[model samples]
Structures are given as C-alpha cells and as structure tokens.
Target chain A: MIDLRELYQEVILDHNRQPRNFRVPEHPQRQAEGYNPLCGDKITVYVHVDQGQIRDVSFKGAGCAISQASASLMTEAVLGKSLAEARSLFEGFHHLLTDEGSGPSTGGDLGKLEVFSGVREYPMRVKCATLAWHTLKSALEDESATVSTESPNPTPSGGP
Target chain B: MVKTEATLVAPSLDPGLLRPDFPALDQKIHGHPLVYLDNAATTQKPTAVLRALDRYYRRDCSNVHRGVHTLSQRSTASYESARGIVQRFLGSSSDREIVFVRGATEGINLVARSFLGPRLEPGDEVLVTAMEHHANIVPWQLVCKAAGARLRVLPMDDRGELRLEELGKVLTERTRLLAAVHVSNALGTVNPVEELVAAARQRGVPVLLDGAQAVPHKAVNVEALGCDFYVFSGHKAFGPTGIGVLWGRREHLETMEPYQGGGDMIVTVGFEGSTFREPPARFEAGTPNIAGAIGLGAALEYLEELGLPQIEAYEAELLSYATQRIGSLPGIRLIGTARRKAGVLSFVVEGVHPHDVGTILDQRGVAVRVGHHCAQPVMAHFGVPATVRASFAFYNTRFEVDALEQGLREVKEIFGP
Candidate 1:
C-alpha cells in the first residue's frame, strides 16, 4: 500500500496552504489558460519574458492540493530563469512525476520541486501536478491559447 | 418529503444478507475493507447477474434474431425475454416500447435524433432542467442546434429543488418537448417529475424523463408517471454496462424514424431503398448486446425478488442516517439538501479541495465520486467547481457510512489548520 504521507508531503501541503505568486503578474507578456475537464481544475499562467529570460512568473487557479502547490512551486522555480531553462525544468518535473523508474534522487537538479516525486504513485494525480506546468509551457510557446489536459492533439513537447 | 407508493408499505432489507451476493463488495483495498459509495456512477453486479452472463457465454453463444440454428433461436429468446423483463420493470404497457440502446446517453440521442429532431422547426424550443446530466442536455442541444431551435432551461433552486412555478413560463407553445432528470444525479434531488409531466401534457408537449439516477434507488412506473418517454441505463441499476432501455409511448415510437440503419432493423433491403422493422427492432439497428440484455434481465429479477419497496425504504432510512452523521461534522457543508433526495450526499469540506478529500478517503478504502459528476450546470448552479459525493446502494450499510465519516475525519486532520 502506498503511504498517503508520501503523496501529500509537508512541503506540498504548506505550498497548497500558502501558495506564493498566486496572482496575475502585472503587465504580463504571455498568458495561457489550462483546464482539466475531468476534475474541473483550472489554472491560468502568466509570464513576463524580457530578452529570453523569465522576468516574472505567476499564476491563479482553483484546483487540488497537488495542482495549486505545483503551480506555486513552478512560479518560484521559473522566475529569473531563461525560457529554455524553464522548459528544461518542466521536462525534469514531468519526468519525476510520470516516469516510474525515476525517483527524486535520480531526477537531476529538481531542487525543491522534488516534493512532487511521490505523484508517480497516484496516476490520476499526475495530470493535477502537471496542469500548471502545461499551461506555463503553452504560455511560453504560443502567445495565448487555452490548453486542456484532454487535448486531442497534445503538443510535440508531450502532455500528461 | 415526497412520498411514493412504494415507500409507504415497505419491508425491511437486510444489507448484511445482501452484501455477500455481490462478490466485488466483499473485498479489501489498501488493507481496509472496500466501502464503495459510488453507486450513482455504476453499481456492482450481483452473483446472479454474473452467473447469467457466464451461462449465456458458456452455453448459448450465438447472434440474436438472425440464424435458423438452435443456438440462435435460444439466444434470441433470452434477449427478447430481457426486453419483456424491462417492460414489466418499468410497468410499461407493451414490450414493444422497450428499445435497447448502448445506455441512457444513446437512448436520449435516439429520441433527440429520431423523434424530436425531424419535428423541430426554426422557432421550436426544447425544455430541460438545470439539474440534468450532460447526457440529457447535450442531445437536445444538438437537435435544437441542427433545427435552429432554442434550448430552454427550467431552473432549479439553490437547495437543488426544481422551481416548478417556472414550468408554465418555459413550456411555451414553441416548446416541442421537455426532457428532465427524474432525479438529479449530482444533487440527489428527486424532482417532481409527475407534476412536470402533467404540466407538459397540458401544454401538449411530449416529455422524456431521464431515469438514469432514479431507477436504481426507487420504484419507477412509467405509466404511473404519465411521461411520453423514459430512459435509464442498466449498469447503474446493477446490470451490465453497454446496455440500456428507451421506453417510449408506442404512438411516438411508431411515428419516429429509425436512429440508425443496419441488418436487424430492416424488413427488406432493395437496391433503391430498404423498409425498416417496427418500433424496438427498428431503433436497435445493429446486432445488440444479447448477453448484456440477458444479464440485465437477471438483475431486474434479482431486484424484483428483493422488492423495490423494501429497498426504497431501507435506502431512505440509510440516507437519513448518513445525512445526520455526515452533516453534523464541523466544516462540512452539504451541497444538496433537497427535502426529497435519494442515496446521494454531495458535500464539500472547508479549506480542503474535493480531490484531496477523495484521495484521503481512498487511502482509507472509501470509494466515492469526486468531480462535477457530468453535471457542470448543476455544479455551476451550486457555485462549486466540484464536490465529494458519497452515493449509496441497497447493499451498503451504516458500517460503511461510519467508515466514510472516519475517512473524512482523517482528511480534515491531514488538511486541517
């Protein structure tokens, strides 16, 4: 049996309780909306990119603990990083949550975002942990478009 | 409280005795005994239903109503007998009225496409309740859209009760048909469908009662309800998935065009055109789910043996007990508190998302539905994105409800301030 504590870690709970950057960034250059029609989870990601570097990142949404916390951690992790670096981080984060063989220690340089490593145990929640990341990725790629977890043709970057 | 004839003279139903009949119910998940409370989604099939499926597949495996072979004859008999069972179960006048479809969704689609779609005009309108499941709403929307007709909604109150007063205003001359959920799946509100059907009749409009959620909980007599059409899924009523019944008035069924065209639904095929079969066979285009229909017959027989009146009374008592037990908990707000409800209890925990609650409860082996329940409009009406719904069945017990309460307490503790 999987331990509940593994999935709902203390850091994840703390982030869910007091989500940082849980707001729309002022004068955002790129914005995108993400929705999981299955669970009614919605998240909007905003990024202000200046000279290929993420000047600011923030989000606002209503979702489960994993989704809200993931978004909160994402905003903090991606800030001040270049667009490519943020994309790499998203890739690593996605790998940690979905790849069954990969664990927190094996996932290279996930930093505090490693808290979502336990999400691999709950297959249903991987989408929850990835909703904001997908939205952020869409915001970076396209100017603005609504991204659903249930998108028929997922982006070439892959989707949950 | 809305009292039905079945609930008035009720016998006791012992869940303890009935529980063992369902093999799926007697199991453990994550070290705790599985407490399945997601009956509104689908029910666990009983041993009788399982045996019926096994027997049919093992002995009489043949296509229905096609060949002159002995096995085909036997399969056809069983399949048609299943329709007779459904006809008797719904108290419809003739077995000809029961047309088998994929499920309630397909059943509604048939009515929308075949019956109402051809008759609709540019200004015609179709009325649906706000609490309807997407199956009941989307089909009408499609038909109305194709015909350039308006789809009107009969609003429900915050308590999840239908505003019957609005029926007169919504049931205008332009209204071609009224499709409403006999019971709201999300809210558990047992709508006054009798009144709504009567009002639609007075307006000279046809009515289709979506009994997907209603048939599982209580006794439903379509003739008594006086509706033009009634539809329900077999899976939700402890039968097999992929099979359901569309019980329409013979007059309506005879006049409507076939929803699909295939071998079994035809009388004779020519190079120019093909004449269709009558009523149920005409609507059931392809080879139907013969085994599913047979299993559904066994399920209905099982329900009949137990008596729906007894099950209804037993479930009502259980619901009240659950309502009191779960409602008394702190920080738990019940989303749907309609005076007349079935076995559904939709609630939200303070400071905790329904998904989190569902996860926590699942850890403790309490299975529930945690989402919009395919009723987004109902959720929107309640101003909630999603809700944790614990729905009951005849085989569920107070012990299971207690387990739910304990699981919820754990959720509160883990997410508590």
Candidate 2:
C-alpha cells in the first residue's frame, strides 16, 4: 500500500529537477565522496565549516529523484546550522527515512525535509534518500576517506 | 533455418498456454497485473519445477552418496539423474562432464581456479570481450593477478557488436585462454561463439563460454558450438536458485585439479593423504543443492517438452516486438542494437535516470533492472552511468511490452517531456 504521490511529491520532484547546492565549493575545509555502486550513484559532498558552524554545503553526483532531491534538501537543512546541529539533523533525517514501524515520522522538527517521509515505505529507496547524508557525515568525520553504502546485504538489482 | 524463419512470422507455442504454468505470473503488483520483464536477473519457475522441489523435500530428503539407506539411494539417483538431464540439455559427451555448482558465478570460479589457475604463467594472456558480465571478468582477473598473467579485452563498436577482427591481433602465442559470453547480458549482443572458439582452437587456446544469459533463451549445443567449457545458472532458465551447471570437455575436466575439498568429492580420506574421485565428483565438493538439481531437471524437461526451437523462435519474436516497440519512442536511445541480440532491451531516456525509469515502471507493475548491470565497462563505453534493462523470457507477451511502453510514457510525463 505504498503511496507513489507521497514518495514523489511535488516538492521532491522540484528539488530533483533543479537541485540546490548542486556544486562543489571552491575552497572547502572538508569533502568526501559517497558511492552507491549498485546504481552507480556517486556524490561528493563539500562543506565550508568555519569554527564548528556550517558555512556552506554542496554536492555533485548523478542519481535518482529521491537521492538528488535528498541531497538538495539536505544542503538547505544543514547550511546555517552548527556541526552538532547538522549531525543531529542527519540522525533525525536517517530515522525519518528508515523507521519501518509507523513509517517515516513526518510531523517533527525535520521541517520541509519531512516531505521525504514517504521514502520509508520503499525500503529499496532508503539508500537513495540517505546517500548525501552519509557523504556529509563522512566529510565531517574524515575528509580523506570516501563513504559507500555497499553493506554486506546490497540492494537487490542495485536500486539507486 | 526454415523452421527458425517460419517461427519469426508465427510463434510456435501460444505464450498464454505457457503463462499458466508459471503460477507467479498470474499475480498482481501495485494494483496491476505484474509484467515481469526482468528475466535477465531471474526467471519465474514453472509448476513442474516447483512440484519437483516439493516432491524431493517430501519424499527423498537425504544426503547424497553417503548412506546405504533407501532414502539416500533415491536422493542419490535423483541427483545423478538431474546431472544426466543437464548433460543432455547441453549436448555434452557424458553425464560425467556436468558438475553442479551453486550458480553460474561459482561455475566460472571453479573453472578459473581448477582449469586456468595451474596453467597460467608470467607474461601469459587471457583474452576476453568488452561486453562480459562481472561474473566472467572478476574471476579471470583474480586468477590472472595471482598467476602473473594479463587480461586482454576485445573492443566493441557503438552498436554493441564485438570487434572480431581484433581477435587475431590479440591472440598471440602467450594467449592461454579465451573466455567469452555467448550472449551479452547487458547489451543483448550474441557473440559469434563458434567462430571465436574455432579461432581460439586454431591457436591451441581452450575457450570457456559464460552461457548464463544464452542457455535460457536459445538452443545451446556445446558439441556443435565447439567450446571447451560452458556454464549457466539454473534459476535464469526457470529452474531453482543455488543450482547451476559447469560442463567441460572430458580431457580438461579429467586433468584439472579439484577446486574444493570435502567429504563427497573424495574417494579415500586419511591424515597422510587422500585420493579423489573422477571429474564431476572431484569438482563438486559439497552437500550439493539436491532439491535445486531435481528442480532443474524438471525445468529442463519442461523446456524439452515445449521444444527449444519453439521457445527460441517465440522469444525471438518477442525480442523483435519489444525492440521495435521500445525503440520507436520519442526520446528513447537504445544502448544495445546488435543485429544478433537475445532477450534484452537496454535503453535510456534523454534526461531521466534509469533508476527513476525503473521506479515509475515498478509502480505500474512492470519489473525491470536499472543499473550498471554488473557491466560497468559497457556503461563507460556508452558514456552513461546506467540504463534501464527489460529482458524477456518465453512467458512474456506483447501486452507486457505495451505496458512497458506506456510506463515509459508516464516517466516522460513525470520528468516532463
């Protein structure tokens, strides 16, 4: 009983069509690459964090609607927040997209980002919705290493 | 030739009649009748194969060749009979040549380790095509890396056809093996394997054909094809998973070292030294997938009853219909357009990602694969990240192709034309 409208909302599609922060920063303090080898969806997240406060966040890659929109939405959510706030938002967004109990918690402080709450219904697209966030985490933690969602159990048929 | 040509104009068997045999095909998905076009990934099983699996589990569920009990004997007989069936299906010289593996991946791995592992030396070469699946490529790369051999790839044109002229230039004295795909899983390019085999043979190089995508769609006579080794997964051919066949020439199988070591593969066990059995048993060092083998036997029987010629011809018609239907779209660009293609249609819309295409199609109850298709080199060749793949089987119909076309139209609307 998954709702396609919920998954592909107008806002989500708008973000996918023309993503925000879809560029790599000229001079970024931290950056890391994330790869979903399943669908060849790769993203490089670059952040210009100044003294623990996030200054700029952007990404460059190719992926599906969910992944591209998620990346766009993620940049907007974390741009002015502090590193701590960004990390917290990452957790909140991850929870929202993966909580299989009652589906993604839409009514929360997740803000406009709650539009992606329907992604929880499609387990295959969870990876797509979280690709940018994982890269952002990797960029914050270790800029040298690239992040990958190629877990022991890969997505069936390499869903993006 | 006349039979094949005649079938192109008229399908031999009514696909609707065969459709009922596959119980899974009679279901609904996303509130619509499921249109399974992802047979390249795996095919739905027929009732006969399912019944065989059920019968084996209910009546004869015992370890093979280990016990003197009646159940053991029955199970052993059934398992051995399955091997014979596979041997006949592939037109191999003997049942002893058929070795049951976990799947095509394992079968290729077995050959890479058992046959090519020992013979490869420094400066030696293993020639392959640009269109090979990862199953064929990775194992050879691992073996060549360990053995200090280099892998040479034959190029393909924009139409996804392999450049056979380059074969002569690449086939030098150091070339030890020629492993190729009988049918390209990603591009649907059916390689001229007999010609390739003959070329390899002239230079005294043994060849292995990864027939995973070919065996299910066409009549594969290994004897007529003149390949030294051939492998295919059972699940792709409407049989069960965890079961595949690795058929090799008697000379190669007899001389190769055992790929694995365990109880069943051995003739005598000792702390000092243990002797092994002949070709098939020596290679199949496992409590093999007994039920899977029996199910595969049943699947082969189903195919035999339908007749391979009829199935091939029927699928060819479906392939043509699908290709024409999908290729005629406004913004669609087909990735693979080889003249001799099997049941695969890989393509991309102008600005839409294949994943999006797949999602929209899935919403309409049309199943397809969208990814690098484990053929990243092919993706790189096409200069695209991925393409949506709709692979057909004997059970697919023209109606499903229409569904796919309509699904693509919806995708165009979603992304905006």
Q: Candidate 2: lDDT of B239?
A: 97
Prediction 1 global C-alpha lDDT:
0.91
Which regions of candidate 1 deviate over 4 angstroms? A153-160, B1-8
| lDDT of candidate 2 over B4-84, digit per residue (tens) | 454755337788888999999998998999999999999999999999999999999999998999999999999999999
Docking class of 1: medium
| Model 1 per-residue lDDT tens digits across residues A5-121 | 899999999999999998876677899999988789999999888899998889998999999999999999999999989988988888898888865666468899998988898
Off by over 4 Å in 2: A101-108, A151-160, B1-11
Q: Per-residue CA lDDT of candidate 2, range A94-146, in tens?
A: 88877667545543478888998888778878889999998999888865877
lDDT of 1 by residue, B121-153 (tens): 999999999898999989999989999999999
Fraction of true contacts retained by every candidate, in order, equals 0.69, 0.58
State the weakest 10-residue window (summed lDDT) of model 2 chain B. Answer: B1-10
Residue pairs with backbone overlap in model 1: none
Q: Residue A142, candidate 1: how far off, in angstroms?
A: 2.5
Model 2, DockQ value?
Answer: 0.53
DockQ for each model: 0.54, 0.53
